[model samples]
Target: MTTPIHVMSEIGKLKTVLLKRPGKEVENLTPEIMERLLFDDIPHLSVIQKEHDAFAQALIDRGVEVLYLEKLSAEAIDAGNYKEKFVERILDESNLETKPVREGLKKYLLSFDTQEMVDVIMAGVRKKDVTIESNHLSDISEEEVYPFFMDPMPNLYFTRDPAAAMGDGLTINHMAFEARNRESLFMEVIMDHHPRFAGQDVSVWRDRNHTSRIEGGDELILNDKVLAIGISQRTSAKAIEDLAIELFDNNSNFEKVLAIKIPNVRAMMHLDTVFTMVDYDKFTIHPGIQKNNGEVDTYILEKGEKPGTVKITHRSDLQEILREALDVPKLTLIPCGGGDAIIAAREQWNDGSNTLAIAPGVVVTYDRNYVSNDLLRRHGIEVIEVASSELSRGRGGPRCMSMPLVREDLPAR
Candidate 1:
């Protein structure tokens, strides 16, 4: 029997992947709440969906099985016959204003079939959409003009942040922000009841129930034996320590964790935003992330002398670390925009460093980053360009958008 979750390497041939198509939620973004919701700007709904469809097609064209999170969530609840239980969980995290409002939202959500129920929750529930029965006439304040009873999950399209697929297991992340925190709840529901993953041996190494925050974008599977998780603005150091301890003490193939630290600014909010694996010997990196001599603050985490503890070793040169970890003779770090001071900063903001590797020496990247795209091609790498006008507005490229479910294992060493 094939394991439901298997991601041994980041640059392995992708067999199956998960994506969330842009929906009405994109249209729900308003200037008033955009920043708080982690959006730099609002996107045009029609164009973004068209761009997203093309992106999905690009994956399908590569013979990869694509799964939609929205479809799976709907099917999971219906298959498990747990509609009421699912709705209750969503409302529980929604922070409804009052008992009357909570009951009203529950009834309205339950009225729809599973699919629409999922969509409505994602698109957000407008204040006027539900009717609440209150004993007093002044239950809802007239001066309270805030739009939504429930906030639209505009960031749902980036499925890579809520959960990460690792060696025969995955992590249901505790997201860093409240706006994106509830996004994991949807994945939790799907994992619990979805037919494809429910009965499988997939392990949840860490779940979203903790206050220590971690995100999938910070998690990278280097090979069968080593993993790279970043200490960035979105993922905390404590979370990485805890996850490393779990892998060290548990029955897992992962033997080491490289806790590399990056700038905490939003431009480099996640590690993948500025660095990603593009091939067995090639990686895309932003020059700005380096110190005086291309050195990054890196630490190696391994099983300690004592049980259930991790041993840490300090390292700086990223190239040396990669060579030792993969046992490669030489590794090339491809610079975004060819490491130009101005070009690197500009394209890095648009996620030029975030390329999704479908196969060794081949990657899918946003076409708008022509300079970076050209650089990858010149380095003897296969670069597949996708439409990016609307997609780049979300501040993520192909790597940030995708969550690989299965990948063909690389031949031993």
Candidate 2:
């Protein structure tokens, strides 16, 4: 079998996807850390896992290959040298100075399988007494030293935030928050050294100083010829430009890059929050934001023999522009929440617009986004709703639960 290359053309034809099943870290989310971790509330791990499994099954049922990130990361670690480098990087980045804690972390990293490793990394080392060196005039006894705390990575379940697939390779996104930086590092190691993806080129948003930060959710590959990047709260203009330069330098497939600026609102943290493609000529969109009256600005960067040029202007709806520019005949726009003003507003806030397309006319969504589901069904689309009581509390739905790695282009309808 040939090693799979990443080149997504349509959401429906996705052949491979990356997912992280919710774990103890998700359950441990407290109100205190919810906002810090970019969550609205805590969720029960069991329920969330069940829902995620259903979503995964939906994709599998459609013959899509689902690769759990935790599994891949674990297998990558078994490669020996790469594992050591990954561990050292984690230790150095986390700044844990306690000998016992460091030892515990090392042991944990070596002992767990892929699934368990994912859990421990997210749940984190328990708070316990740790030995540390001290240089104080009045020395406190080592026995009385307090336990050093290791904060659980509540946001790790949202794997879409750290790294993104760009063309045939990957881009390791530098995260804005320090609390989640370790997750990014973990993704970087996996994409760079994993056995399944050996010898693949990788891109980094940051330079040696590590100032750049971007997220996969904010990045969208419209086609081999175009990329739709969202400039949102999580992704900066500078980061987009940096990514553009990298793409220009390495990838020869893309001809244009569109920077769609979205409001920095908590609700609209990424472009996928407002728009996502479901089929070759169909899309689910939050018109309120992607339209002219909305808070986003659309710009196009066309590539030539040399590095491309950018053009900015007010324009028609994203769906309209994409349809006209790409010559897609009879593009369909499915509204979230059944197109009812009230329902659309409420459901969209609950991640109604965020559905992951398994294939043409098939998708996964939150059961709680009833209005959106109703709309999808009315459009003759199949809506597979996963339980959301626990999953919804985390402020993400089906789309956030999955990261598509490879998609086959659909023929024009």
Candidate 3:
């Protein structure tokens, strides 16, 4: 039996991946609440969908199986005969205040077929969309300013966040923000009930019901035995420790975890935002995450001599650490925007460093970051550029938008 979820390294040849195409959810963003929704600007739905299609096509051209999250959610529910249960769970988390409103909303949602219901959920329900017959003051209150009965999941297109596929398993994340917290539920349902995954032995290294927060954007599979995670705005330190303990005790191939701490700011929200592996000995790094002396806080975790514990070592030199982890004599850190402060800052904001490696020495990137793209070409990397005008508005590049499911193992370097 072939493993359904196997991601041994970041730079391996991509065999399968998961993506969420931009939908009505992008059009649901309004200027007033855009910031709270984690979007700087609203995207033109048609254009964003076109760009997203091109991204999917690029992967398809390279023989990668592209799975859509929205389609999968619907399939899982229908296959498992879980439509009512799914609707109940969704409403339970949507913060629909009153019982009347909740019941009305449930009826409204159930009216749609399974696929349409999933799409409607992603697009969100406006207060005016559902008819509520409540004379209660709370229902008729002066809350006209707020628009949604259910908030739009503007970040759903960034399929990389809700969960991460590790070696033969995955972590259904407890996302950091309320806006994205419910997104992981789709993954949970798919893994637990979908025909393709239900009977599979896909390990849930960490489930989403925990109090501690962790986002998939912060998780990185450096190699079969080494994992790099970010302690950033989205992932708490406690969560990383918890994950480390689980991996160590479960006989997982992962033996060491590098907890790299970056500034917990939105600009560089996750380690992948500022750092990502590109080739066997190459990585793209945004200079903003480093100190003046080129140092960043990093901790090395390994199985402890005592049971139920992990040994930790404080480290600062990222370059040396990478070379050692990958068993290479030398490693190269390619600075985004060619090490220019002004260009790097501007391009980094557009995700110049977040390149998705489909295979060693080959990557997919945003065409808008010309300076970074040109620099990558100069270094002998096969750089495939995709249109980014609408997609960039979401502040994610190829890496942020993709979730690799399976990759061919890299032979010993």
Clashing residue pairs in candidate 2 are none
Model 1 agreement with the true structure over 1-413: per-residue lDDT tens digits: 57888999999899999999989888899999888888899999999999999999999999999999899999988988989998888899988768898898999999998899999999998878888788755446532678788999999999999999999999999999999998998888888989899989889999899999999999999999999998999999999999998888887899999999999998998999988998888899998789989999999999998887899999999999998899899999999999888899989999999999999999999998999999999999999999998899888889888899999999876
- Report the Cα lDDT for residue 144, model 3: 89
Better of 2 and 3 by TM-score: 3
TM-scores, in order shown?
Answer: 0.98, 0.86, 0.98
Return the number of clashes found in candidate 3.
0
Better of 1 and 2 by TM-score: 1
Pairs that clash in candidate 3: none
Each model's lDDT: 0.91, 0.70, 0.92
lDDT of 1: 0.91
Candidate 2: segments with Cα more than 4 A from true spot: 97-118, 129-148, 200-210, 290-296, 304-317, 339-341
* Tens-digit per-residue lDDT, 25-85, candidate 3: 8899999989888999999999999999999999999999999999999999999999999
Tens digits of per-residue lDDT for model 2, 134-196: 443222243234322456777766777777766666677778777777777666667566866
Candidate 1, position 298, lDDT: 97
**Candidate 1 worst ten-residue window by lDDT:** 136-145
